[model samples]
Target: MPSRTRTHNHQLSDPFAAVLQPPPDETPAALQARVEQEQEQKRVSDQIDDELRKERTERKKRSRREVKVLLLGQSESGKSTVLKNFRLKYAPMQWKAELRSWRAVIQLNLIQNVLTLLDLMQDRLAQPDGPRPGSSGGPSSYSPPSYGRTSMDSTISEITLASSRSTLNVVLTQKHRLLNMRLSPLREVETDLRRRLGAVDPEFTFANGEDGAMNGVPGERRKSAREFGVRGWIGALGFPTSGAARNSDEPMPVDKATEILATLRDEIISLWEDSEIRELLRAKCLRIEDRPGFFLSDTARIANRTYVPSDNDVVRARLRTLGVQEWRITLEHNESFGSEWVIYDVGGSRSMRHAWLPYFDAVNAIIFLAPISCFDERLAEDPSVNRLEDTLLLWKAIVSSKVLGKTTLIVFLNKCDLLKRKLQSGIQVNKHMLSFGTRENEVGVVVKYLKDKFKDILRSDASQPRTTYLYATSVTDTKATAATLNIVRDGIIREHLKHAEFV
Candidate 1:
């Protein structure tokens, strides 16, 4: 067998050494021509290598990620569908729950993304039982799953049954396998330093809504490390997600998620920069993945793969904090250029309005979607005021002290299709609307209006990373919509991310 060497640091096709070698000495003019030819060859090789990587990913994928994007808005704003979308993507195994309190349900389609098996875990259970703080009882009989156990999917969305709390806790964890799975998916390896350090449970609190005070636990602080479900209770611990899957003795294309994430991350940042709302940093929460590496590989290979089972230390993505409700984050990556995003979608429902605040400080960009189908009599005579009220709150928070203008805000005039439909129905708009004679024209004027205001209103001493223009976007679940998004992605986002001068 061929012995493995240190992992490749350059693009697979180019090799690090190839990048370092200088061209043969030649006349300055001839060197320029030679360089162009070299560039062309490298591009072709990149395309080929891209195809190879995609093939590898698709050959064994089984789990499709469904992100639980928490949406927040007032009573009338859309919220239910956002939660429903999450269910459609990450609905659990045998999930059975009344819609009485929850928002929506989602079950991801994996057949289309068979290469993700390496990314999926069959052992869905991730419960760790622990006695109360002062109790001396045995560790909660529950444990994060032994190495390589797998759970078969039972085709039920929910089950209302009774059982001991121990089994119930285990079952609850199993139902949310995908969510628990994303908490980094690979566990930390056992380390002496981690064991030596003492653990402390820092108080954890988050608001249920924007401007909503942190309502979790106030009177007491639980030692986070002593908790049962806590990994390395009473201390800090984590290992590489990539290292767990690859044998120290074996070789692999990428050893850490960061390299994979870095390549993917730069592309996402580029897309954000190119957005028509790139200045606004809006219209970007969309995702693209599962095509495998750079191109499509045979779907059949993805549909079939020999299963290898082992369990060592893979980080579980579950959010486990005492006195805190559990949450699932199923983060996934795709070969497509725009698959790295985890958008907190704006769903139009009353229940979802409370989820918007906590993450505002963390996101690098914010897409403030303003629907065009409003203020036509049913909404309000004062459309902008009504719209501004909700939006102003969001803007204030993102630019607030916690975020400190760290995030870029992108405003989008969403549902442009609604405008076209209105025009077709003989609804009269401004003179500019008639001049364009189509939905596209009406949107252009609206975008122009937003751009001027963005430049005018947000030009302030405190705005560190400047805010930019707004774009009119139409997001429908269709091919034309995808094409439209791709154009904005290429022409706008890509351009700005590659802006070397800014760096």
Candidate 2:
């Protein structure tokens, strides 16, 4: 019987097999070369396999070590800002790319402000015949000279209306220029931008309405985020209500949107800063201060040709979290903690709270943010309910959750900066918050009072009480937040390691 020969087959593809197989009737030198080539290829393949196996081993170890953190708060409670800060710290390149998309959102915010201001101005101008709504209607104490009084007053009022109309007319033209020049359906603009960058997933829309509470929380009503501003803005602008074909013109370059705002920057700022316009707004009870991106005052800077939003600007830019967004970032600073960390930023509105229960059981820790500055503010969705009251209720629900009872809880009494400013401005907290009666309206005093209130709730409501840590955080301050994040990271790592040891 012929001697049998054994040949090892590595699963090489057809192209590789042809090159690897030795020719028949090969000479010794040729056979030696083929053997060496085969050995070399095998060595490379084995090295790759070794590396992959090591990676798998490491992945398994990391899966056991992974930490999941949830950011919980009411809408605009600064949860997303906290998430952005994390991205800024650990994934700057990605954050910088994200800023490009934010540019459009910023522009929309600016447009929204201008549109609102103009509408109020027009309403006031239209009503020159009587005292502005909400204004004191008592007759003037000093009567003007009777001579030609009626004719002169009528002439002056007509001229004032004519002037405002002229300004409104100009504003109307610019508004159309911006809206019609391919600015609608901001989603497509963002999507096109991502496509240009070779991104497969659609970009996240950061506008602050829809899929959230109508007022800014979940309980009001669910509206499309698109319907919040862009879709409805056309009718609001007093333009033809007819379904004007969506600005199908080529996507406006980010820089082009900036340029459009720049060209109209003077008009926008003038209207914003006009003392007369300000008076009218106050009379109309249109308080822009409570709204997001009140940029009329910052027009010059926002409209600058080379303007790139700073970290603070991006934080101040309002976008309501519509649903749960997850980010997986490799931990670089606290290497002892784990290989990766996953963070979930859920929409803080009431309706969105339903989504939080699923995450509670899985999250290793919770960063609960409450805007202490919001004590005097009212919930946008429900005006009768105080914002601070809503925050307190939300905090109670989170800390008391049965599923999350064991999760590490870190409370961030956020917006301390705004709180300090509000106190210093001589705004009486007791006047707005009756419960705050008889207490000193000082920053330190108010902060401690608020902190104690939160702690009392936690102490009373937690299913299984543990030490709940609190921080007076102003997330806009990167250095301060970074330091706080480190403390949080270290605390989490220690707990994780201790838990693993016990397990």
Candidate 3:
């Protein structure tokens, strides 16, 4: 037993002994040389270890100095728009570099508007009792579908037929058919552009009840079925990063789309501007102008070959965020507030909310955008819930989160412009929100009411006491938003410094 134990111990030590052993034929001079060589190696190893330690400490200091902001809101609530504003302000060079790429997206937006109009026109024409010229009625009684267990087709059909009884008397002639045929090539262009934009994923599939679609569908069908979103903006825009190959001469997908749009520009304008078509749109209660990424009104300018998207155009551009996007901007002029700012933009759709949990930790501040204009609107994914209701619920969940207890909460009652427009158009706020009852329907009253509601939620639901900033904003108005952002930037910096013990 003692011999066996000795053998086991010897086996373990054999490898160590081999490593410690020196050359059997070593002379004193050779031994001295080996010792010196080992000593030099040890010195190098120690130097590397010290450098690594210093690097780690520096990384920690940099992280501590970095200011992280998160943009949160429901889909189309202007989260991306706010991010663009930040980039345009603090990261102008980077924003300018990516400006040309937005041409494709703008073109795509215009094409989509055209296509939607064409589809509605075709659907109208197919009806046996289509509205005749000069037909008029009371205001549209159409209410978009509430959340119910129904197939997508049925929901779409209901929406299509909702305004059927109130449609403007517009007749489609053979000219419309000819124009649609002329624009058929646009379908191909759209498919090509979507492929180039990385909007379609072949491997992924949407299950039923996901994204509020009732039927399971392959990701390939998402081209038309789902709101457009690229997997990553860097890859989608073909923006070159470090070590990425750049092919300056390579043909871009936008070029083809642009060429096609330029040729069909007149026809598209004619289709869009036709008095009959305008009446038809009004009759069907299809407010295409209200949709995100709308560019029909700018068709002529956008379809031009030399078109460049203005700063306002980029801010208004709607690119659905699929996951979380991190944008880092080094403050060029403001050194006292920290040199580095990291902004996280997340997908706010109900289906995408799961992706947000991982980011809640370590966020310094959150800019939550609630589009007050959407009080009457329903979530596209879940039509049953009012947009305002959904926003409040989301705000409650965010404030009540224990992980985000220390984070500063900032609320931008966004899209005040749209809210004003809607109010002026005679949409009753109380009709959509019972809680908004008996209040004067003025914009100021509506905004104040909504702001107070948000404040109430923050006060009641927050896990800990914290300061909350509320601003009424029209985020699309670059000038006004810039001013608001300045105030917001200072507030964020102040909070950051306080948290960092620099105050």
Candidate 4:
């Protein structure tokens, strides 16, 4: 009984002895093969572990080492223009690839302007209180659209309002669907072009809303008026096999863009130059030249079958922002600063300003653009407030923000050229801004005064402890802007390096 008890105790202590037992010896060849198989398995396992560790290291480095910049400004203040300049300087290949898309946007702008003129013509004709041609009353609502021309050609002028009305009616009757109230014909083409360029319609927000809440649910994409233009052409036929492979059998995407623009060019010009249309625009004080792609002046050339948009033409094209967009590019000329830069551009409208908050934490630097030329203009979204005043208020909020204490603040006093021209044209600064106590309206004086005002605002927001670099820039001039940006890039890199040493 004592012996049996001893055996049971030993068994309890030796629970893993079976797993530890060695196998019986094998033949020499079999042992060698087994050893080889074990060695191969170990090698593959180690390789997989090494790969996983390498990927983790790369991810951590990317998160910690990337340089980020933010572009901030009000709508139409030239933020996108600055972004484009960066592309032209650093990413020429990508820039060229996207240039073809701008032709469609330019064409869309021109077509919309003509449509506005046409709508005005139709509205005037339908006005119950307005005098008809040759019908006696007080002064008629027949003021001609001012192209700065003294008169229309006698041959066209002789076509009186009544006759011109008939001519327009005949044209409209034949193209009733195209001339409909929805402007579907043009919109369909516009939608297709926008889609190819990966554009979705932007949300509308209340003009003064601080949160930038959308009229609809946030991030919900809405359909524009119509969507059946050039896309239909592609579906009914077929897309080129490849955008890079250009031949008779497979024209490039750029060629397709050229064809669309050329097809619409003459039709847009004809409507724009119509005697009645011009007169209506004049009466309404609507100047299409002030708009983007006033292609009327160069219709013959732009309409040529061979024409493609130049880089400058693409730069001049305007499209409003909808939300936040981020662009990442590798540094080519300025490799000392790190290999990559990520830039964030947000919509500058009051409502869209809310979208800027989430990015404030991670941004290394901020480029704030305030168009000094906006002193005389009003906000397009909110007419009650002067644009310059709003810009100043915005600047105060940004520089004073406790959240952005570490962010290097660069203020671009943009559109200096436009300010100079507006001042030269006798637009008095004091007249628009009563804050100026009868100061001279010269460009140099006004610019200095404006800069001081902005500086004063920055000073009042001193709790945040920041340095402000002010640059007088016209972002449209690529050479000058590029020079300024080089200085900015270098400054930012130096500051980042300094900060890194402390961390």
Candidate 5:
């Protein structure tokens, strides 16, 4: 047994002994030098370990200090707009850096508007009894059908309106055809821009079930097959990361798109400004101006080679958020509450709501945007679902969530400007929501009614006792939104401090 133990020990130690063995003819000075070298290596290793420990400590501290906020709302409820407003206020430098990149998005918006108009014109021209040269007021003025009490009734009304419009006809002139032919090249530019922006499907068609269906004739399917979206905002602009690309003389995809827009500027302006085209759009109830990312009004400036997007323009720019986007902003001005903030801008479509559950954990606050203007509208993904109803359901689900029991809830009854416009245009709220109950259709009353509804949900549905802050916001108006955001920022920071036990 002793011999077996000795053999096993020898086998294990032989490799270590051989590795530790120095040169056969080693001098004292050489041995000293080897020891010094090993000492230096050990010092470096120890230093690295010390650094790793410090880094871990700092990360833990930051996790406690970081203000994590999640922007929540349905699609087109102004979540992204609110995020842009935050960046505009807190991260001005980063926002300015991304401004030039938005030129492509603005140009794409213009092209899409033009293309949709052209398609509508083509569809109108195809009708058998198209609009005569001077036809005026012959059962031609279009009025949207009234919204019924239930969502099913609303859907039926929409379907009825769509079916009724299919029988009406309109016409276009030779000038319109020539303009369409000239603008055809923009289709290729649109394709190139989509490629650069990382659009999931280049040939994707935006169905008319949402707001502003092409020609407002949903059944006829005169929709434009142009939608530009990116998987992420980072590097989507195709801008240079390092100084290497700046030194090169090559033009980027955005540059080419800019050139095309400049070349076709006159045609685009003419098409947009045509009186007959305006009349046709009015007749079809297609208010292209009210649509998100509408830039045709500024075609002259936007299409110029020297065009640069202003702060308002960038805020108003529409880029669909495909997934949750993390934006870190270090508050330069306010250091008392916290320095670093992480804002998660999540996709708000019904299909994307499933991805939102995991993010609910550890979120410091949730800024829920409900577009009250969409009360009379149906969800694009599920036509049967009313948008306002969807928002209410989502709000109930969020407030009742045990995972978010301790989270701070902030509700922005967003898009109030659009809501006012919609109300002013004779859209009654009670027709769509019976619970609105013959209240005044003024902006203040509507906002209060909606606010009360949200408050009621919070009072009844929250899993734990919590406080909710509510605001009436038109996020597109940066100036007003900036003021509102200041209050929001301070409130969130206060809650964060309380959670960290610093208050």
Candidate 6:
């Protein structure tokens, strides 16, 4: 419920350079010989383990094959969008919510996805990592029975087993700084826009963009994130609520918020009851409630469309993709020759990610965002930077956390189409460093370039050298393919397999 306080000025060169960890020690030759000798007697036991795994995979092939996936990133990163799109084949537009809350749910899913990714990494890495975070290697053969750092129910959990087939545990830990890069909704926009409709409204004051956000006053007070969502309607909306109020007690005026949603829903549903209204809603494709107030008319209508619906309860519908099924799991071992994984996921705001690491003592892999196309842009020009800093802060938190290399690390270079375009167009973006007057499109560069320039950010005590892979993607569609993600996911799993061999 707290807004992140990390500022760009706080992000500096990694000062911790002397702490790289040594690789895991190999079994001494004599110890290895002894183990091999012991293995002669236990050959049947090892064979049984192999046979069980092969059997499980074969059995799972005929089933739903549940794989736990965790998604992690800063606030507003495309983690949720990517996940929503990933399962598009199963159910499109399932996780609906008011837009702002949609972002919140996305954040939660991100955390869940992180946990799920860890489950996959751990299950795949199950072969060699030493005792998992919470397992003791029993026939229960299940992941550690604990929830993540911020399980949705963070309360007493009921343990239920899947009908026993094949499943993977994953964890998603997303630390979103700013929940949404938007302004207040339902303000007197008609009054303000009336002064200047077609033109970039003149009342929108932005003499400069400092402290990373593009909303600024060159020499005076800067505008808050609330203003940018609607190009500065603050006077009409009064001062936007503080971070605390906005996050918890009140997010926008509840009365106005509900009214807006109900109005849209009524308008859209009326169309279904009558053909004319449906046509009108389709041509307009709604974009209101600042940023997160997305929704729809009926559950049936929600299931019927892929684009933003034009009608009631548009907030949540816009936020969630239909039937979002993201997940993450971490299993810590209680015995030897086995290990555990802790997963994290999307729960908008870096604050959510900040709550995920302790459970990660069992983490086996991390899914990080490396929007390569972002490397060619500057944060200042990025229209959605209100929440970008939180992501970096979250990354900083990860690189500096205690879960160094109990697992493998995978960095997805998302938004690949954008990156590919920039590279083809000969544009070079730098995320680690930024200059004045940089444009929005350039912010991608900074996001992509953060690591190459910030050494301390990725330093860990583990000897594996925390791995990263670039996954280029475009959720709204610009020639992005699931294959790109497959390449990234497969690469991470393959390397994870090699790493697990030592466990």
Off by over 4 Å in 3: 1-45, 134-167, 201-226, 242-254, 334-337, 501-503
- Listed in order, each prediction's TM-score against the native is 0.30, 0.67, 0.81, 0.70, 0.85, 0.36
Query: Which residue runs of candidate 2 sit more than 4 Å off their true CA positions?
Result: 1-54, 128-255, 284-287, 331-339, 431-434, 501-503
Task: Rank candidates, TM-score, best first.
Answer: 5, 3, 4, 2, 6, 1
Quantify all predictions' global Cα lDDT against the true fold: 0.31, 0.61, 0.74, 0.61, 0.76, 0.35
Model 4 Cα RMSD, Å? 11.3
What stretches of model 5 exceed 4 Å from their correct place? Answer: 1-20, 133-171, 201-216, 219-225, 239-254, 334-337, 501-503
Give the local distance difference test score of model 2.
Answer: 0.61
Most TM-score-accurate candidate: 5
Candidate 3 structure quality by residue, lDDT tens digits, 318-354: 7788789988788767575467989999888888888
110-179: candidate 4 lDDT, tens digit per residue: 5555455554545554546554444443223222221111121111111111112211211122333244
Candidate rank order under lDDT: 5, 3, 2, 4, 6, 1
Better of 1 and 3 by TM-score: 3
Per-residue error at 326 for model 3, in Å?
2.2
In model 6, state the lDDT of residue 216. 20
Q: Candidate 4: misplaced stretches above 4 Å?
A: 1-28, 127-188, 191-202, 205-264, 270-287, 292-298, 501-503
RMSD of 5: 5.0
> What is candidate 2's lDDT per residue for 1-503, written digit by digit as tens?
11112122422335565564455467779777867888999999999999999999887777668888999988778898898788777665545545544555566566666656544444434444544334343221111221121221121111100011112111222443343333233334344433333322112233464332222222112111221322121122222333232343434354655666677676666667666656544433344654555556677888766666667677667656656877787754546655478989887766667888888888789999999887655555444455677788788787777888778988999989888877886666765554566899998888888888888888888888688889999997888998998798778766777766335
Runs in model 1 deviating more than 4 A are: 1-333, 336-340, 346-354, 377-385, 388-404, 423-443, 460-462, 484-503
Q: Compose the digit string of candidate 5's lDDT tens values, residues 315-401.
A: 888778877888888775757557799989988887788888889996899999999888766666655567788898899999999
Report the lDDT tens digits of candidate 6 across residue range 1-503: 11122322223333342132112343468556756777786998899999999999865542222133456664334565555444331222222222233322222222222222222223333445432334444212332122122122121122211111122121111211011111112133222332232212212334453322222211011212221121222222132333222333233333332343333433333323333222222212211211222222232333221322321232122222111122322112222221122124444432244455444554445666644444322233233332324344556666655555444455554555555554555443322223312534444554445444234446542344664454445544522545665564455445545555332
Better of 4 and 5 by lDDT: 5
